[model samples]
Target chain A: MAIRWIALRIIQEIIRDRRTMAFFLLVPIVVMTLIYYALLEDEKAKLGVVTRGVARFYEYPLVSVIEEDEDIEIVSLDIPDKETDPAELDRLIMEEMKKGKAHGILYMDQQLLSERFAGERGAIHIYLEGSRPTSTAAIFSSIAEAMDDLTETMPVVIDAECSAKCANSVNIKAIEIKKHYLYGSEDYRLIDYFLPVFPTFFVFFFTFIISTITFQRERVRGTLERLLIAPVSFSQIILGYISGFIIFSSVQALIIIGYILALIQISFTPHQLFALGVTLFLIMIVALTMGLLASFMAMNEFQAIQFIPLVILPQIFLSDMIWRIESFPLVFQWISYGLPLTHANIISRKVMLQNQSLWENWPQLLSLGGFFLFFMLVMSLVALKRNKNN
Target chain B: MLKIEGLTKRFGKLTAIDNLNLNIPEGLKFGLLGPNGSGKTTLLRMITGLIEPTHGKITLFGKWTPTSRMIRRRVGYMPQQTAVYPGLTVSENIRFFGRIYGLSGRPLEDRLNDILELVELGDKKKEVLSNLSGGMVRRVLLATALIHNPPLLILDEPTAGVDPVLRLKFWDWVDLLVKQGVSIIITTHHISEAERSDQVVFLREGKIIQQGKPFDIMKRFQANNLEAAFVRSTNLK
Candidate 1:
């Protein structure tokens, strides 16, 4: 009952604070929306569709969808009817691809469009620029969908598979994907890769900041001393802070994840969403404890901000949230071994993508739980020591 | 209710409190009078167990070392700062501090009303502490301290910055507490204010230069008032 009241009081205090409410509840979504558009939104994929059948290509049903995509600039290069050599047409497309002007190319067989071959099924060839694998993959799939629309009359051959000689094989009717995903389906987008980890980062960052400054303010305003003189124990105080702040932090994580999902349309099963929510709660608990421990060292709000560089930045730089962790050097990689976010990022991604349970991801859960317990113990010690006015 | 002997707190070369000895018995209104940096706060902090003494033998209620929780609950301490939560309303702050000291339900609500009446904050129960006047916030602080109804009340400079009318009201409540046999220990630099205590001491550099009733100290120093008596006691010593 006592712990409940303390927790309730803290929640009431934070809810009543307008500045804190704006930062925790409002700032994250606004900034996250900006980041979603800036980093993940694909507004500039260039695919060169090579075909003398310029008018025929516009007949593709998905052409309307493709045209509405302002991110992709489709420069239709005209080959001179059946008179132009097929090899010359493909060579021109490859030339444009090498210049990096087009990330992908679609070569429509001129013979298939001519009257002589009109009775026979036409074939289309897609060539993807090799520099950026993800962008190359996205453009390839988009063209595949466009050909899937035209597959009833024409056979589409990817650049790597079945050369132009096999394009007219009337036996095969539909597009065939030679490679399959071991994880997500071919329909997955680049934004899907980060859905799991971004939620964790958002939760950790906001919770760390709000918890630190608010705890420091408790000391600055002298309420900490007053609390010390109460019958409340140190452990109870830490528990109260955790219970108080975690309620809102969990809501923040869910709100961000839900908003991003609605905007980006990444489908998740109820089980996956639940796992994400649970993992976020665990990470938020870690952030809360870590923040309280740091607050003990800070005498003022500015000193609390000093912890951002000292702790938060280092954790972010070393974690997989920024980039692939393997790209980091040996010493820097070793730093991530100690940082709990590394484990959290890995675990959240696995849980959301692989549908791993708490037991399946026990090692990561143990590491994150260990960090949580370690910080909690340290926070208790710090809170107990600092309770007495110095 | 309190005892001290050889109580000394030294910050390296600087001794903040030195060889202080005093006894504050039950039902007595005691005051420690000193100028700024005269170790008044340090002395009060040590007694409240907010900070441990460097070298001292101290006892409260026959126990030389009370458990931390006991020390917290047995003494109602109101510091000079407005320790109430500024974001919380009067009723919320009252209930919060009361809950912290293990008060709740009917008894808690009753004490909240009683404390608001005592502090004369009966109408401001719904107002946030930050929006309250300085004197009102101080009253809220005192209400929180007194919420648990601890026998010993230690108010550190309670009326220091409060308006004159509020200070008089605060003293009137202190008189009521004394009549109820609640042991009260107050610290202040206001010599005239310290004169009303049953026993008062003027400390300098952590050492007691004057210890007696206010009138007796005035007679001993041959001064017309406590301010003059206080000036003579510290300067002469």
Candidate 2:
């Protein structure tokens, strides 16, 4: 009955509260739809390519080029020693590369223009720096195809003619490669990657929404005093609250998971579902801890609301929703590991997408559980001490 | 019954309740009257276990130190302000505090009906606290404090902003609670209400300047009203 009454109050409190409605129910779905459309649905990757003699070939009808005003940030490094310069100019170019001012550099040797080189054995030497690997690969493939077209017009040399044991090496052969998938096809889009994170994201959003606003309201409304005086021990109250939110957050998790699986057809392994369950549970605990901390710090609801960007934005970014930890610097990986959501992401991806077992993830599961328990203990103590002192 | 000995509370350099002591047996309506900063609320808060007195012993019903939950269940506290949830309806607010005291079902419903009638807020039970008038909210706060039928009731300022008609009715309700063996501790500036108290303790600067039956104290000060007597006592100090 106590749980039911409190749950009813929690429901009523959220339903009547406009900010609560906005943050929990509306924001997650809005952001998810927007992110899905902004990143995956009909979105094109923008590349800045710097070309030397490969421009005409790149403009061919078979190539897909997405042109913006700032497309192809071309930088010309016209020098004999462009790749290995010892001059101040080379230092400046290296600085630009380090500062992300240049994506790729291509140097075309003037020897290609000579009529002597236009006959049987002449070729254009392409010196391309392959950093900014994606752009480099794109440019290299396009230029290499164009160069292959140039090579078609010239007579081929047989350098291995004296090697009698390899006489069939001169015989031309064409190989065709075909690819197939057993589960997710090659067309398994970017949302497949984002699908795993949506559960974590939604859980985080709802937990944060429910805990922060409710706890802040308790503090501001002065009913916290009433609770302090009640027969319910502070720890019990905290425990009850944590349990209540966990119940609600689990529902939220199931809802989002169902949506992704049923409406969106995102494949998730049972282990991944288990990992997601653990993640949602951990997120609820983190939310309770954050809410208690926010309750202690914020003087009003507006101040508590300010914690959303300060708290949630970093979790979203560092939890590998859009970026991977290995792709980040070493220092960032350590920082991401320190975040609860990072563990959630690891466990969820491993279990859901990779089909890993729970026992194998005991280390992460224990760490997240330990963090929640430690926080619960600390928060309960703080709440007790604060109520005793206030 | 509540008992205090050598009760002392200090906020940094300033001592709020300085080595104080008081005792109120069951069924006694005790008044803790004091000027601003005289530690009236501070003392009530300590008794309710909201704040701990640094140097004193507090015994609730002969227990040396009462746990918060135990004292909270039996002792009703109405803070100086209307501490009810402004968003909740009056009956809902009462029901919340009632459930905190472990009251529910038919008993809780009956108690809710009784308290609303006691506070003369039967019609406003469905009204949100924020939507109610200040007087109505104050009455509802008193109703909340009394919802559990606690043996000890402390009203920080139960009659503030209340019209004289309701103020008289409020005291009459206190009298009824007293008749039912419930102890009452009230703080107020209304001398006429203080006159009706079973006992009054005048405090100044965290010290009890005078304490006795209200008419006796008035007679001792040669004043016709409790207000003049309070002024005389403070002036003498």
Candidate 3:
């Protein structure tokens, strides 16, 4: 009940606070929309299709049909005097691929379609830049889908025996891949990545910033002195603060979760909800420790403001939210290891993606639980030593 | 309800509060007086369990050493500095402090309104703390300190930036609090104001140079006021 009071206060602050509300609501939505539309823009990707004497091929009904057509630009390059300069054409396409001007390069041989091969399917070689995995995959998918219908009409030669698996007799070896998603496979956007971590992150970040300043304010305001002469104990005061912030952070999480679910189409598995709760619990404890530590380090509000960039930025970067942990060097890896966010991020992603139970992630759960206990102990000790006036 | 025995606090080799012995028997309005750097603040902080004394124990309500939560619930503190959250509204600041003290619902709302009216900022509750003048901020700070209605109130320079008229009004509230059995220990350099206390402890360079009722100390030191007694005790001519 005491904790509930503090949480309500936090909610009141958020509702009455215009600036904080803007940051929490408008900023993420604006950024997510920007990324979505930007990625959806057809002009972002360039494809160079080079075919020998195949200008007529573009008029085909199959070629007219394209995947996310507006999002991709298809540039057809005629193999200008292909017999006279075939190597030059390949060299030019490779250059375009290297410079990222073209995502993939396609080549078609006119001779393969002549004489005895007139009724047979001609080989059309496709070369992807391979520099960017996403663009390369997109180009491959577009061409594969187009050829699916065309291959059935064209008579193709077979050289090897047919088998249930690894059949090599067909002229065009078309492979189909079956994809199954655990969490979100249909819409793998930037916002989806944030959905798993932001609930806990905001709770941790806001709680730490608010609570740190609060304790210092108590000392500066003379409330600490008044409390000392009363019948109350120091532990009760600390608990009062802890309960207050826990309530504040919880309300924040609830609001964020409620908003995302109501306004956005993101869905979560039932098993993942426990991970979210536990992640929030661990993050709040981290906030509890950080708030206590910040109070000791700062004597004034100005000093506390400067602590934000130092405190917030590192946690965002090193937490493995934006990039893979393996991308960082060994030395920096050690620093990420020290951050509580790293573990929380990892655990959140695992639970959300795999729908794992609490018992399955006991190791991470134990580590986070240990961090909570350890940080709480450290904060209590720091609280014990702090002078009410300072 | 508060007892201090041989309280000593040191910052490295510099002793801030030296073997200070004091007692505030239940419901006494005590005043701590001192010059700058006289450890008046230090002594009060040690008693409140904000800072642990190096060589002594403070017993509150019969407990040998008070825990933070117990100490926090029983006392309301207003420090010397301007401590209100500048980013928050005047009402929000009071409400936050009230909530931390476990006050909520209709009771919390009533006390919040009452304290705001007491501070003469009932009309300015919507105003942000940053926009308020220094004097108004100090009043809000006091309002927050008194919100919990703790049995004990510790105020360090509660009237420092306050105007003379407002300062008198603040004392009126303090006196009312004492009448209701709220024991308060306050530290101030304003000697004239210290005269109103039931008991006064004068400190200089981390030591209590004189201790007595305001009238007795004034007469014993042969000084016109508590300020003069403090100056005379420090041999300041």
Candidate 4:
């Protein structure tokens, strides 16, 4: 009965606070939408083609075919007489990339053009701006397609009139680029690669903030003291609060996950989806316990909010959500290991992207459970101490 | 019934309640009156088990240190801060407290209405607590304290912000509850309000300066009112 009332009051309070309600439900959608557009892959790649006595390569039918077929914009650059030095040409390419005139520069010099014509091996150098990797990759692939086209059709063009000796030396063969995906498909974009982290991150963040503030309000307003004086045990009160927060936090998680899946059109099997849900639920539980424990250290709502940087931001930066934990130093890696979000992110990515089952991620789930239990125990001890000191 | 012996509470070097002792009989309206910082609320908190005493013991209903579930169920505590959910309506707040105290169904609804009517907030039961006036909020707090109908109700400054007319009504309700054998432990700064209790204890710096019936204290101090009696007793002039 005590748990029911506590949970009911929490739900009512959150529902009635219109601003908090919007923050809980709508903020995630807005943030996810902005991130989606921010990380979206560009459809067109612009290339600056720098040629030295190989400008005729740009006029080939195959180059035009690739330009039209792959949605690539190829701009031809004339090599100045003074730019004959490779260092000067490199400076010119860097300048073009810095000016945002192209995503990448494709440099095909006289030696490479002559080698292609003479049926010998040739290498084309491509310089990338390196800031926008997705577009740079598109530019690189478009140029590679054009080169492959040239390789395939060069033999046919020479076979009509070349002698048998020239034909025998023609070793220009198209590099067969067979693609395989170990995890995701070739059509997967940046958003799909990152979709699994969004729901977990946003849910964890917002739930933590809300729980901390709400619990702090209870303390400041003396409702917590009143509860402590009531017939309910201390553990029951904590359980009640946890159950209370879980209701809305779960709803928030569902909305975010559903919105991402629907908006990004990512597909998962029913079993994989269930595993993902379980992982998210565990993350939500950890976030709630974390918030409750943080509230114990804070005296008011402002102080509770102050905990975001101390408590939530480190998890975001170090949790392997944005960066790989393996790349971090040993100390930071240990910190990431101690954080619950790190485990949640790992489990989420595994369940969603790798199609791994929940049982396969038991260690991470157990770590999350341990974090939940630790937070609950510490929060209870704090409550008891505060009660005694009241 | 509640009993205390050598109840002393200390915070670091400052003693909030210093070597105090008292005995409150059942079915009596007991008042602890003092100015701010005199430790009236601190004494009430110790009795309600909200805080631990550094050097003392509290016996409630013949049980020493009544932290058990049975003792908790028999006691209802209303802290000084309006400790009710501001976003919830008055009835919702009462209902929540009722449910927490193990009241439910028809009995809960009936008691909810009874407490709301008793507190004279029946018309405002649907109003959100934050939208209500301060006095109405206080009334809502009192209503929640009374919702479970505990044998002992400890109210810390229950009528602090209530209007004169509503304050009188609150006393009348307290009188009715006392007549029904409900033991009341109330802390208040209003000396005249303490006159309504069966016995009042005036605390000065955590020590009892005066304890008796209102008229008897007034007679002993040769003052016409309890406030004047309190001033005379404490030499506050």
In angstroms and one decimal each, the interface RMSD of every candidate reads 2.7, 2.1, 5.4, 1.3
Question: What are the per-residue Cα lDDT tens digits for candidate 3 across B1-237?
Answer: 888889888988889988878777877779988877989877777766666788988988888866556666877888887766788999998998887777899999999998888788999999998998988898888998889888888898888867898889888988988998899898888987988899988888788788889999879879898887777767842
lDDT, each prediction: 0.75, 0.68, 0.70, 0.78
- CA deviation > 4 Å runs, candidate 4: A1-170
Clashing pairs in 1: A43-A71
**lDDT by residue for model 3 (A1-390), tens:** 989999999999778866456556765674454344333433334566655564335325445654345545677654465343667776776666645467676555454444213334445566665433345557667767766665554334453233344353445644232222223444555455556677767887888788777776766665554554445455676677778777778778888767665644456766667567778877787777677667656656655555565667667766766544444556656777777788777787666644556667677777777877776677666655655323
Question: Candidate 3 or 4, higher DockQ?
Answer: 4
Writing each residue's lDDT as its tens digit, candidate 4 over B1-237 gives 888999999887888888998998999999999899999888888887888888899999999976777888899887889999999999999999999989999999999989988888889989999899988888888889888899999989888877898888778988988988789988889889889999999998889999989889999999989999999988852
Residues B1-237, candidate 1, lDDT per residue (tens digit)?
789989998776889999999987899889889898899988887877667777887898878953367777888989888888989999899899889898889999999999988888899999988898888888898998899998999999999898888888888899999897789999988778777788898999999999998889999999988889999987888
Please compute and give the TM-score of the first chain of candidate 1 against the native first chain.
0.56
The candidate that wins on TM-score is 4
lDDT of 2 by residue, B13-34 (tens): 8888888888887888888887
**What is the fraction of true interface contacts found in candidate 2?**
0.73
Candidate 4 CAPRI assessment class: medium
In candidate 4, the residue pairs with backbone N, CA or C atoms under 3 Å apart (3 or more residues apart, or in different chains) clash, namely none
Worst ten in a row by lDDT for model 2 chain B: B64-73
Error of 3 at A211 (Å): 4.4
TM-score of chain A of 4: 0.59
2 versus 3: better DockQ goes to: 2
Per-residue lDDT of candidate 4, residues A211-319 (tens digit):
8888889888999888887888877887887788778877887888788889664588889778878888888888888888888877557557767656776677678
- In angstroms, give how far residue A69 of model 4 lies from its true place: 30
Weakest 10 consecutive residues of candidate 1 chain A by summed lDDT: A173-182
